[model samples]
Target chain A: MDADVKQHQMKLIYDRYVRYLFIASACLMTIIILAIIIFVGQQGLRTFTEVSVSEFFFTTKWDPMEGQYGAASFIVGSLYVTLLAILLGAPLGLAGAVFMAKIAPSWLREIMRPATDLYVAIPSVVYGFVGLTIVVPFIRTQFNVSSGFGLLAAGFILAIMILPTIISISEDALRSVPRPLEEASLALGATRWQTIWKVLLPAALPGILTSIILAMARAIGETMAVQMVIGNTPQLAKSLFMPTSTLPSEIVVEMGNTPYGSAWGDSLFLMALVLLLISLGMILIIRRIAQRRLA
Target chain B: MSTGSRLISPKIQDKIATGIMWLAGMVIMGILVTFLFYMLYKGVPVLSWEFITGEPSDIRAGGGVGPQLFNSFYILTLSLLFSIPLAVGAGIYLAEYAGNNRLTDMIRLSTESLATVPSIVLGLFGMIIFVNMLGMGFSIIGGALTLMLLNLPVLVRVTEESIRTVPVHYREASLALGATKWQTIYRVVLPNALPGIMTGLTLTAGRALGETAILIFTAGTTVSRQLPDFDVTAAGETLAVHMWYVMAIGLVPDRIDIANGIGALLIITILIFNLMFTIPGKLLQRKMGSSRH
Candidate 1:
């Protein structure tokens, strides 16, 4: 009886410790996020020793060779591409979501859903390569621009890259709307389109909005694809077709050339910090929306 | 009829809307299909046994991608190895242990935020923490450690989701039988969740296999001279990074061909990897008789 009791005691103690182990594992996630922000922030903040915050955030003069470090162009360029991608991609994603949720036969949904999943699996580098070979040239020739590697090209690539996120999320949102609501609308002499737009859409708007903001966050932070197609020019673009660099693009383009602690390197780290903060802010925004939804 | 519907009846509008949605689906599918075909068309001719198995050359015309291919799998395996336990542990806490409270929500949000951190930023973090601070120095271990960050959020999410899908009755039955909570989770819940977790892991692995930015700085865009070099300290350039290097800065005369071949190989491997899990996953589900389908 004592031996059996000992085995049971060990099991009980082991179980308790394992629960603490799980809790610690979760805590580690919070630690990683804080560590990234601190380290990236620490390195990036050093750039201000040489360049003023106003000049860094508000002006476009970025000649690191001469110690000037204004970064307005990269910041603006990131916005232009991210917004343009949403403008291009979100409507199609919504339509695709609706089609999958309310229109497509189950067989079709089965096929397309996996195919869409494959979209996320494809590498950003491959998308960039395809954009370089096909979209950039097509843009250059079709628009008669000097070059096609610019906000337009980058936006086009990012739109495709973000489709899976938008579609999957919004589809779930739409699917979650009660079927009785749709049925009531249809039974009240409303067309299917009316039911989707007036009843289903209103119900799912919060989730759809969440998906859009999340997609925006993704579009803003996409690096290799944007870098390859945006031409990595530090100057602001004069036209959609003109070349300009976003934060991620410029960082990748110049990171290899700069040494570890030089002003140039710190400035690049600062740019990465900016990207990180923007994404963190996005998480807060998403959390707000989720809370409002629950309330 | 409403005022707006006077000119265009609801019936006609529904028809048009249906057509438009169908057109949207068609267009997206068309683009995806065209892109895949274009990649395969340009890449398949460059692929060969030699291309798959030979050493990469510095400036030569016909350098193979053998090293990069090996590094992709090796780094992927190592990253998954490092991340799966911690992520699964956290996931179990979220799904089975923690109350549905703000604390759990905050924990979940932190994991999701990790997902939102750009790969480029993560690359720099890895570079700072592993490459410089720890002095792992452009090694597979350094790259794998950084890439593990990318893997963690996805694994935790899938794990929580998979665990949640295991019916509540399964747990209740185990507890009713006087089984300890840990035993119930380990023996019943995890086994039922295994198929889902496996599928999710394969998907995450597919995504990781083609990751470039995280590996670029952390892994140091160069490879060991020896074939299949297993030194954890050796530079671990992967297939995706190799393709990017081939285009961006490579001076190799056959850089374009190399890029194409690598691109095609990446897509093929991802397809195989995803399918690998799916078939076995279904079989496992059937063997378990868990009623998932």
Candidate 2:
């Protein structure tokens, strides 16, 4: 009886320790996330109040050297590049996913899926290098320009970089399409392609959109590759061929030795904040959709 | 042929649609091929034993990525060491022990959400916490710890799924044979789950090897090309970071080649790591399928 009591006590201690560890670790993840938001928010807000609101918000000129900084141009650049990336990347990625999930032979699917997966494993830095050497030269020659680096070039590179993400996510969505749905479409004498389009595609639309939005989030926050190829000019451009700057790239360029003013720091912080908000919004939406589907 | 016969559309329309599909497939394949070809063309010339082993001399002129290479290996080794055991253990608890607890569900939700968090935010978080609050400064150790945080959720999710897939019968039989719970988990459950764990490790290692933004915030952008003094924490640049430094900051022609060499090396390393996961899983799956047949 005494031994049984001792064993029960020992089990209680073990249970308590494990439970506490789990709780502590889980709480730590939330704490880390909160701390980041607060720091970025605080620093980002400093720029808004310190700088003239008009100068920071309305003006297109971003001469950090002359200190007449406005993020209008950089913001435009990021948006333009991201839009271009989505335009080019989404179709290719979705098609590839569909082809793999629906049409490819077993051996082809086996080879292609891993091949696509390998692209994800390839570091962004390598992608940057490829863009610098191959894409840059191709753009220069094709456009007959001195500088091959521009918003369009950067967008193309980003599209390639993000392709794996879109492909994988959309593939999952496509796979979730009920087999019965496809079979029913086929029994109605629809062609394979038609069945895919009329039946599977509609069913998979939300998941595909979710993946595309996630890819967009990636493009918006992307720094190293976009920075490497975007020519680092903070000017609004009418054409896709023109040089550009992005918020993340600007933050990376300026944050190291930012002038000791809250305005500049806050502006950078605000950009981070915008990015944070975008990602948070995306996650919330994805979570809702996921919960609904899973539930 | 049956597909063609069933498609009783105007022959021209069917032909056109089929043609467009074929064209689209060709274009995508072309892209994949061209990307590979261009990378090899630009990146291969610089790949050499001397280049791989040499150190960065003048930031602008020329040197090998010896330091960055060491940093990559070091960070990969250390972060995996710290993260895998904890992640796998947590996964085991969730998959086997939790059994529908609300807390476990919360953990699952959080980890999935965590996977979607943009890496840059993770970088910013690491900077404030590790670099400033913890006073680790820009060092190898700092980067490794930061990486551990980024990788943990992914490891947990992958490990959990893989562990859950292990047959329940194995666990029940082990218990029925009078094995202790711990022994059952270790002997019966883990062995069956080894392939999946390795698969998860491969993916995690690939991400670790290729990770950049978080490292940039925590690990300073200094590339020391000499032989790595593993004893010192504050000394090296990772291969990915080295590529960025060479292009954006270093401003040297020779450094560009070295960077290219390192870029190629990094891609090859990751590709190999990816294969490690894929090939084994495939072999195992095939074996299982054929046995069932």
Candidate No. with top DockQ: 1
In angstroms, the error of model 1 at A134 is 0.6
Q: Per-residue lDDT for B131 in model 1?
A: 96
Q: Per-residue alpha-carbon lDDT of model 1 for B1-293, expressed as tens digits?
A: 37768999999999999999988887777778887888999999999999998899888788899999999999999999999999999999999889888878778878989999999999999999999999999899999999999999999999999999888999999999988999999999998899989989988998899898899999988999887788989998999999999899999998888989998998889889878996698688777774544
| Candidate 1 stretches greater than 4 Å from native | B1-4, B100-102, B282-293
> On residues A1-295, what C-alpha lDDT tens digit does candidate 1 reach at each position?
9999999899999999999999999888888988999999999999999889999999999899998898999999999999999999999999999999999889888788878878899999999999998899999999998788899999999999999999999999999999999999999999999999999999999999999999999999999999989988889877899899999988888899999999999999999999999999998998899899999
TM-score of 1: 0.98
DockQ for each candidate? Answer: 0.82, 0.39
Checking candidate 2 for backbone clashes, the offending pairs are A44-A269, A44-A270, A47-A266, B56-B225, B60-B252
Q: Could you tell me the lDDT of residue B159 within candidate 2? A: 79
Backbone atom clashes (below 3 Å) for every candidate: 0, 5
In model 1, what is the error at residue A251, expressed in angstroms? 0.7
Clashing pairs in model 1, backbone N/Cα/C closer than 3 A: none
- C-alpha lDDT of candidate 1 relative to the true structure: 0.92
Q: Give the 10-residue window scoring lowest on summed lDDT in candidate 1 chain A.
A: A108-117
